[model samples]
Target: MIKKECCYYQSSTVKDDPEDEESIIKGMTPNPLLKKNEWGWAIDPIGFRIALKEIYARYKMPIFVTENGIGVREELNENKTVEDDYRIDYLRAHIEQMKLAMEEGVDVIGYLTWGCTDILSSQGEMKKRYGFMFVNRDESDLRDLKRYKKKSFEWFKNVISTNGKQL
Candidate 1:
């Protein structure tokens, strides 16, 4: 089975009071320990692990993670490169959770990211970028549309080359 799980920001510190029905209905409160994206979504890796475990427990089928990534506002530096350390940290934490899930026998078959290059967001916003390769363009104008690899690109390449062992 194919599962697409996107991790959202959650707070470990704040627990919903079970007695309070409103709290239960309201769901998790967002308290980002790491950082939030441009859209204010929490960058929580634990969500990924929880999703994997829940899906595996319920379905008992091998899962293919088809889409997972973080979107952030990126800007090109003077060197024509994007130093997206936030993206790297986000992916690393999620990947670590996936690895842990695998250790716990989640039966994950494969993993794929949301996008490889910057593009229009689902909300049709170009500023909310998600990709290892930054596309040179904005919401208003398409300036050259050149592709530049972000810092996360090389880090992810190494992670893949090492089969995630180095991560």
Candidate 2:
């Protein structure tokens, strides 16, 4: 990894706890850096650019965006389709920053979002979903784990097919 200068990079947004001494020392506070969402920090696409530039400058390496996305409160519509415009916008903004990084000579090889299908998160919950495909079952109720393609599914498909030119 060091010789090739290639590594996987993940980006996300975070806010410091008000009561934490480290946060107080660093003067970190909940700001408008990310969208306000109930699940967690909303998407902060510029964070991708900042992190990519800093890492490239420091390591001079190729980066594979391994896991980057937002967890959203998604629900199926009457037609059982998920119109996840939030997810699309989130991905588009991040990808735009990635393009900027490449323009600035950052060797970005690939990108992948977290939880491509609705699955158990690190916290083992299904409510906090980050996926292009939506699974129909939640935790503790595995009656029928039906999978449905979300609106972002075709969006991402086109992105991959066009090499992101269409996006």
Would you estimate the TM-scores of all the predictions? 0.82, 0.84
Estimate, for each residue in 42-128, the C-alpha lDDT of model 2 and write its tens digit: 355676788888888888878878787878668788878799998898889889999998999999898888867987878988888
The 10-residue segment with the lowest total lDDT in model 2: 4-13
In candidate 1, which residue ranges exceed 4 Å CA deviation? 1-28, 31-34
Local error of candidate 1 at residue 158 (angstroms): 1.1
Q: Give each model's whole-structure lDDT.
A: 0.80, 0.76
Candidate 2, residue 157: CA error in Å? 0.2
Question: What are the RMSD figures for all models against the true structure?
Answer: 4.0, 3.7
